[model samples]
Target: MKKITALIGSAQKKATYEAVREFERNLKSHTEIELEYVFLADYQIEFCRGCKLCFNQGEKFCPLHDDRDLIIDKLIHSDGVIFATPNYAFHVSASMKNLLDRTAFFLHRPYFFGKAFTSIVTQGIYGGNSIIKYLKNMGENLGYSTSKGCVLKTLEPVTKDVQKKNSLKIKKAAARFNKVLMRQTAPSPSFFRLMMFRMSRSSMKEMLNDEYYDYQYYRKNGWFESDYYYEVSLNPIKKMMGRIFDYIGHRMAGMN
Candidate 1:
């Protein structure tokens, strides 16, 4: 029997979680794949410190040592991985991005390389494709099989009717994903295909060296700094700034 791990991440405790849970439940009904879900909400993981300690220094695995290492250990052993996250500001949520950033520790590790992986991006209205593209690149560049991944977009106000339809769509997608999961081994690539793979790898290496993720960690005293790390940086400075500006504007309008 195949084993699967579903990495569920959410920042807002929103409706999308229900959808992901339903998708997992649906998958359980069909395949013999043993599924394990690691919900970020339940765990305490520190943000990546950007020190590259996991890669270069080789000191204690990750720069920010916390539950992330333990969570990753479980994911490493699973035959397949499923990343489920919500879309925020036209991309994946901060919690999900932090998790991805921490994966730099395993960049050279064989655990994730060439492993089957999929993704689910739940959003209120738009940006599912953008988030999905981000995850697809992560899979391809990190050596995970990209063929099994998928993206799902949900309606803004999730009602019963929307939930029913969305659940059915997710079930169908999961079924399709299970087919790929069953066949763990990849078929041999022809000479031309092999050449293409080589070329793709070279290109991906170049792009990854630039590393575009902007991850922020917070101190225990609610201060923002690179070295200060927390499991989840809830209400980041950017979000807080937006709220502050909104509050000022609302007060001025009231005075007017």
Candidate 2:
């Protein structure tokens, strides 16, 4: 049985929570999964102080001590993760944003490779689509193979028609997520992701030293010489592109 964790940003059991519940049900129809819902509001999380300790040194050196690591532990143990939030003022709720802020170190040293990730955004009228896009990007930055997320326009006084529509959207999203979750091997990196890894690693090799955490992490992972994050056969064209990206990165590092 696969363990799936859904991080719900809302405090109340409302639209976003219900949407995730429906998603869980739909997912279970496809395969056996143990779904866990994590309500961020129930945990004690300190707002980030922008000290950059986690980025420069390590996450263990952060000043604030809270439940951040506990949440991260759940993610680490899960096969898939779902980021569900209600659109508050055209963005994710405070709880969701705070959680992401706390885990900002993942942007520098991503750790969720080979995991499945998707987003569920609930809104009254507009802006949920953009939030879905943002969360999808966030998942990719965290090294998850992300499925395109879904947004449900959940207005007040929920009618049967709206419920039906939301159910259909949730079902489709769940199916897509399940397929990615069941995959036995990691997917090949896209051209853009390949470029990002090559360029970033090349720049780190040229500009940064062992004093920086990123440089040390890259060196420890052997990213300085690897073609990509994992072993994969790249075509001749992509191999050439990778070299060009490396050259561009080296030039950029020199300019800085």
Candidate 3:
């Protein structure tokens, strides 16, 4: 059975959780996917120190030893991830931001692949699209297949009409998610994703020391030679483009 981790970035289980729960319920109807819920507010994550330990040395070398590893482990083991948050000031909430900040190192050394991602955003009326877009971009960087996302208008008091609309939308989104999640094979990376892989891997291999965790990770994963993070067929033109990107990235890192 596929496991899906639903992480709520709200301070409390209020509107955001409500929207996530609705999504879970709808997803369940389509399939028997196991669901795990992570309330970020309950985790003891410390603020990112900007010391670059996680980026340069390794995540294990981070100064703060909170629930970061535990959370990451949960995510790594899951087949799919659902990030839910309340829109704040036209973006994700602080709780969600904290989680992202702590795991920012993954942008440099992505590990997750062949995983599905869907985001849920609850807002009073506006900015849900922006927050959902942010999470989708994160998923893309982490090697995940992302759905467009689910946005629900959650004004105060929660009217019946709103709930009805939310349920309908959630079910529609879940159907699309489930269909993609159940696919037997993974798709090849987009040209943009290939460029990212080329740039990041070349930069790390050229600039980082052997002892640096990011460099070691690249070696361990054989990313230096692999065309992309995951196995897939690539056309010749795309391969040439990736080569160009890698050469540029190496030159840029060499100059730094």
Candidate 4:
């Protein structure tokens, strides 16, 4: 039996809870695989301090000892990790964010090195794709073999129609994840480590150089800098003024 750990990352509330319940219903279809569910709402996790203790100083333990340790242990022991969350503001909920922050404990740990991962994201409005992409990127960064993602958008009170659609998607995603986990072969650590190190360096440089850094670079390249700021500063005011004019015109037309 393949051991699988599913991390339920939504904050325990009405809509998110409903989505979770629906997902659970779908998961039951696969009775052959041994499954365990870990809920983030039940635990108290702290923000990562950026201490780098797991990699730089200590014996691979996160600086803040909290519920994250147990979660990490479960993930390490499992052959597959399934991340499920509700999309909030085009990303994951606060609970999911906090849990992600805690994963710093396993920065250099071999437990998550090349383990299979699948993501399931539910969004009330738009932007489910963004949330799925974000989780998938994180999974890959942690040396997890990522499977196909599951996305749900515009979910309200869980109706039977929505449930049926999501059930099939979740079941298929879980099956695919299990198949990858059952594969005995794992990725090479030394090669992955070197590639990850290089990627990190490049990504860090790009991140540190945001708008301000871009402005500087463009200025150096003889691109007029003041014009860029002028456009950025004027666009919002222009949009606001345009809306005001449109509203006034509509009222005037109604009066006529």
Candidate 5:
């Protein structure tokens, strides 16, 4: 059975967490996937100190050590990841953002590959959808196969219509998440994704070798010689775009 986890980003077990539980219940009932819930409030993740060590050197060089690795381990071991959060002032709560901030290096050196990711967001009034959008982008940065997220309204005086709508949305999102998690392989990288790999690898190879761990990582992963993060059949246009990105990288290197 595939392992799944919901990283809860709130401090209280409020209506926000209830929405996440609804997602888990639906997913569990539909599939054989093993599910776990992780509350970031329970972890001792320190605030990022802006040292840039994780990007410049390596994660091991990060200044403030805490449960960051433990969180990452949960992420790595899970086949599917769900980021559950209560929108706080129109954004993800500090707990969720802190986790993302700590994993900023992954944005450059993605490794999750075929793992699936989605979001379950709850809000009192507005911003739940926007928060889910942010989660989708972050999931991609971490190299997870992202799916459409679920947005739920948790304001008081719950109307019958609102509750019914949330139930449908929860079921729909769970079904989508389940389907993607069952997909054993990651989807083909898009043109922009390919360009990102080409530009970063080339820039690191030509410059920044002594400045960032990504340079060594690209070399070790053989990404310097490849067109995408993983092997995939690329169409002619995307291949051409990749070469153009490489040319741009060369130009940037020439300027250095």
Candidate 6:
């Protein structure tokens, strides 16, 4: 069975938690999955201290001793991952933001390539859409093939109509997430992802050395020479675009 983990940020068993449960059920209707719910409140993830040790050296060098790696291990072992959070004060809950902040180095050295990712955001009113977008982008940066996530307006005293609507939204999002999870082949990189890889690799190659963890990681992964993160046939046009992006990256690196 495929392993899917939902990292839920809410401390309470409320809208966000319920939404993830509904999502799990809907996803299982498509295929059998071993779903695990990780309540962030149950873990001891310390707030990030803004020390760049994880960036400059390695994540192991990070000073705080906590469960960050344990959570990351769960993500690494799962076939799919979900970030579920409630919108608090127009943003993701503190727990969710703290997790993201602690793992910010992943943005520099992404490690979850080919994993399926999506988000579930429950909100009282107007901010859930933006939270979904933020989580999706973060997933992509972490190297997951992300499905566009959903936002459910879950104002208190949710009427039956609201529950029904949220269920439909969850169902649709689960279907999309399941489809990505069941794909037989690696997804081809989109043009934007292609550009991101080419530009980042080029800039790192030009500007950094072995002293930097990011540089060492790119070298170890052979990203400096690879056409993309994984081998896929790129059309001639994209190949040309990749080279152009490389040139632009080189120029940018030189200017810094």
TM-score of each: 0.66, 0.98, 0.94, 0.65, 0.95, 0.98
1 or 5: which has the higher lDDT? 5
**Candidate 1 positional error at 145, Å:** 2.0
Tens digit of lDDT per residue, candidate 2, span 1-256?
9999999999999888889989999999999999999999999999999999898899999999999999999999999999999999999999999999999999888889989999999989899999999999899989998998899988898899988988999999999999999988878788898888888988888888999898888888888888887777888989999999999999998999
Off by over 4 Å in 5: none
| lDDT at position 167, candidate 6 | 91
lDDT of 4 by residue, 105-164 (tens): 333332365578888887766888888888887886676877777887536666888778
Question: What C-alpha RMSD separates each model from the true structure?
Answer: 16.5, 0.9, 1.6, 16.1, 1.4, 0.9
Model 3 lDDT, full chain set = 0.87
- In model 4, where do residues sit more than 4 Å from their true spots? 13-31, 59-62, 105-111, 187-194, 197-256
Q: Which digits, one per residue and each the tens of the lDDT, describe model 5 over residues 75-165?
A: 8999989999988999999999999999899998998989989998888888788888889988987898989998888788889999999
Error of 1 at 130 (Å): 1.4
Which wins on TM-score, candidate 3 or candidate 5? 5
Candidate 1, residues 1-256: lDDT per residue as tens digits? 6778878777555555666677677777777768787778777767776776565534364546578777778877887778888778888777777777877644443236446777888877777887777886676555566554445556565687867767777887678667666664553433332333333333333333323221111112232221111122323654454344444544544554
- Please report, in order, the local distance difference test score of every candidate based on alpha carbons: 0.60, 0.92, 0.87, 0.62, 0.87, 0.92
Model 3: residues with Cα > 4 Å off, grouped in runs:
none
Residue-pair clashes per candidate: 2, 0, 0, 0, 0, 0
What's the residue-level lDDT of 93 in candidate 1?
Answer: 72
What is the C-alpha lDDT profile of model 6 across 175-225, one tens digit per residue? 999999998878878889889999999999888899999999888888899
